[model samples]
Target: MKNKKILLAVCGSVSFYKAYEIISLLKSEGADVRVMLSDGALRFANLISFEALVQNRVLSSISEDWQSGLNHINYSKNDLIIIAPASANTINKIAHGVADNVFLQTILASTCPKLIAPAANNNMLENFTTKNSLEILSKNGYDICEPVSKILACGDLGKGALADPQIIVEMAKRTLNQDNFYKGKKVVVTGGATTEKIDDVRGITNFSSGKMAKALADAFYYAGAELTFISSNEFSAPYPIIKFSSSEELLNAINSQNLSQNDLLVMCAAVSDYKPKTKFNGKMKKSQNELNLELVLNTDILKSLNLNCKKIGFKMEMDRALAKQNAINMLNSKNLNAVCLNVLDEKIKFGSDQTKIDFITPNGEFDTGFDTKPNIAQKITELAKQI
Candidate 1:
């Protein structure tokens, strides 16, 4: 995103505060960010705070930059327009082509990719008018960042919270990097630890933060792949997400996707190797001193997947010396095009931000020295495209 000009339009939602982190993320990626605020946004966001981060005067009204005479038109010249925390009212106005505010007026004049992140109360967001307007905007080529279901500021648990700042930024990068290479490519990334239910409340799982999978997902999205993230954890993305718990459930979810040979599947989830043979009907009582439960092997998801798509799998081992060998073994056993080897010991922590990976392909082993997950993910993404 270096040197890319971006215009961030903040609306009236209380969640407009999130724009701070959004700005920081974009600037950190070397984007030239300029902010435009709605009148209602002033109540929750300070112009000075925005100006300080962007290192430029914030624009709130059309009259402020009158010296240029084409201020609105010029603002519309950004490489991308992001309407974060796009309130329902603003959405409706945009749907009806009402460019009353400078933000909307500039958007009207802009032909650049537009990304909208809607945030509002449930009733407001689900209202007929609001829903209709969103549908209209989506049909008009606007990239809508679907809100996650969470407890709102109004104390209601529903689907109206603004998307994660990371996801919003990733979607913006995707919009900016939309190109021929990955434009229509399908990428499926599996994540999180799949659980084997022992009872309604208890289950066995692993220590996976899903960050590795998330990094892969984000990298693929930024590369413009049509993305789908299958995970046990809840997430908000501008693509499809299939939720699952047990290894069986995960397999079923992946099967449901109907992947083709053109697709790319990254198997990074920590799927349970064994499941309780006899799952208790409900919560297992602790009355017994010791419970000797029988275990059964779970079907290897990667090997069991009924598709011919090119696949890359993750192999996490305890010994650094044996990690590459184990990854290579899994690569052949699981019929994978490549495998990523991660050694977990005192120095390496699970579910963390940083990772040192070794990539084993049919060709040879390449050690990717210690680096942040995002950087490693980018390298893996580039490797996958070449394969």
Candidate 2:
């Protein structure tokens, strides 16, 4: 946040007081923050409060003096704009280009990135009009910190609370440093365990949770990469995702993506090794006797890709020696530039947040000791920098 200019626009809500803490934290992080209070904001806090915290004049209204008249224009040149405790009315106005006041006028005139944290009654928040307005703002490229669901001052349990201050600040830092490594690069990440349908009611799948892929996607996005995330997981991705359910569907998704030599592909998904040769049209009936099933090997998606992009694959082994062997086999047979190896264990089982990953490449092996998903992603990102 060092030397970054941030503009804070506070709207009316009980959570408005949190804005002071936000400003203080940003300032402590070496950021230069300028505050503006919406008309409704005065209901929760007066101008004197913010003035004392910021140690600068709180911009509430346009000054009559021509020299002071351009304060909005000058302050709007911030690197980022944060609107906390954004009411439903404020959201609508910002969405529709309503700039009747200095605060709105400054936002209207500035091209800096925006992050809005809305706080309102449940009814107002769930209103269809508010939903459409937020969608419009998002489509227009505004970053939103979605309101949390909690007991409001009105005694309703629903979404309307302001996001935590730490989250807002972290997002600010991420937005400000978006020009890090991998900026303007194209990245493709595959996640989750693909299933093979056995019958109408059941299928075969692994225990993958897609957490690793999500972590890598987040890191790549923060680094400014244009990412295409293909996943079979039921969890929502941080960014827009191209979803698939089965191995065939995942393979098709991979085939459909436009990949090139400059692109980076992380094949982290656990695609099914085999699929039932014939799927039952209806739910398979239970029987007292054992049932015989025929199966066929599924296509190897990594080897099937014809692109010249750099590729990474994952191999889960039951033992350390087998892991090394399988890693080398995948690196050579699948034409992967690198392979990540993990030993299947009770503690480091699938879907676990902690993982001990070893990256094998032609140059050497890199071990990222037992670490969380985010730290593992950082290690992978550092390797991406070298590549």
Candidate 3:
């Protein structure tokens, strides 16, 4: 990560102090570092401390230096932008393209890859509105360094804490170093089944173990693409994992990923098509009588995606001919570059280790034959490189 230009954008939060440590770490690693603070962040962060550690003046909302007028515009030339301890206000503003302050204005002007590490109270992290804002940021191609679950400044213990400076730096290094075909490529992968809530405890879902999604993510990572893996399953991987539970949540996850015209989106998740019209906050008591549940169409993620990227959709059907047609229709309807079709059968169980799939691209369809998930993933990775 040496010889790299990095801008450390600090936001208002108890975790503002972490920015100093990050600056120190990045500088020691031979990176040219600059610091900027938001209005709220200035209250918690001592600008002098950052200047002393980074050997440069800190830029803030009231900055009047020679470059103050064109700071945001000129700073767009930097290689990377990182928002440490990103406050709810800053995240919300940036997600919606609000550039009122120096920090946000600079971000809007820069076309470089941005990494965001959010810090706030547990309630704020869990808030539906805040969650949606974060999603929007992702869809705009911002890399979200999700907060970890920990005891925050408040007494409540949950997610809303800034990650360790060491971990943040490591992620930054990975983001900046891309030497393969996937170099600078933004690849978003969605996997697993989305659950529809009937009550607080019960819901409906599809059969998906997310094994194939994991395989595909690993392939993308090894190929050197900036990978964002969204899953409905619980597991650990080397890449950043964004997990969602419902169809709406999955849509938000997909929408939030930072995808560019050169990026690739692989839609492999088994999302629900419908959900209960009304859901009880608390568990409903079981009665002896027959109960009918009202269902509504869930948002179609593929239809909702608005990013300019190479898109691949997945379709599964029992009949081979129907599956081919389904894949072609999905490809044409969504303006996707390719579609992966699977013929389901007794041997191809939900969690099966092997299955047959076809790659239906604009050039035509190519069958991979019956193969293991890993093998299929490798094939998919190669196909992605071609497009």
TM-score of 3: 0.55
True lDDT of residue 383, candidate 3: 82
> Model 1: what TM-score?
0.75
Q: For residues 1-387, what per-residue lDDT tens digits would candidate 3 score against the true structure?
A: 678999899988988888878988998889999888888987876778878887767777666365444377766668899999898878888888898777788888898988889999978877887899999887886777878897788888998899888778866865675446887788999899989999999998988889888888867865668788999998666578998998888888888777888899999999888889999889898876888999989888888876778898888788865777778888899889998888888888789999878899888888888989977887888887776
Worst 10 residues of 2 by lDDT: 61-70
The digit string of per-residue lDDT tens for model 1 on 149-203 reads 9999999999999999998998898888775677778888999999998989999
CA lDDT of every candidate: 0.87, 0.83, 0.83
Q: Which of candidates 1 and 2 reaches a greater TM-score?
A: 1
Assess candidate 2 and give its lDDT.
Answer: 0.83
For lDDT, candidate 1 versus 2, the one ahead is 1
User: Could you estimate the TM-score for every candidate?
Assistant: 0.75, 0.67, 0.55
- Residue pairs in steric clash, candidate 2? none
Output the lDDT of residue 341, model 1. 89
Which segments of candidate 3 are over 4 A away from where they belong? Answer: 1-179
Residue runs of model 1 more than 4 Å from their true location after superposition? 1-4, 10-31, 37-53, 60-77, 84-112, 117-142, 146-167, 199-202, 236-238, 283-291
With a 3 Å backbone cut-off (N, CA, C), the pairs that clash in candidate 3 are 135-256, 138-256, 138-257, 139-256, 139-257, 141-258
Q: What is the lDDT of residue 234 in candidate 3?
A: 85
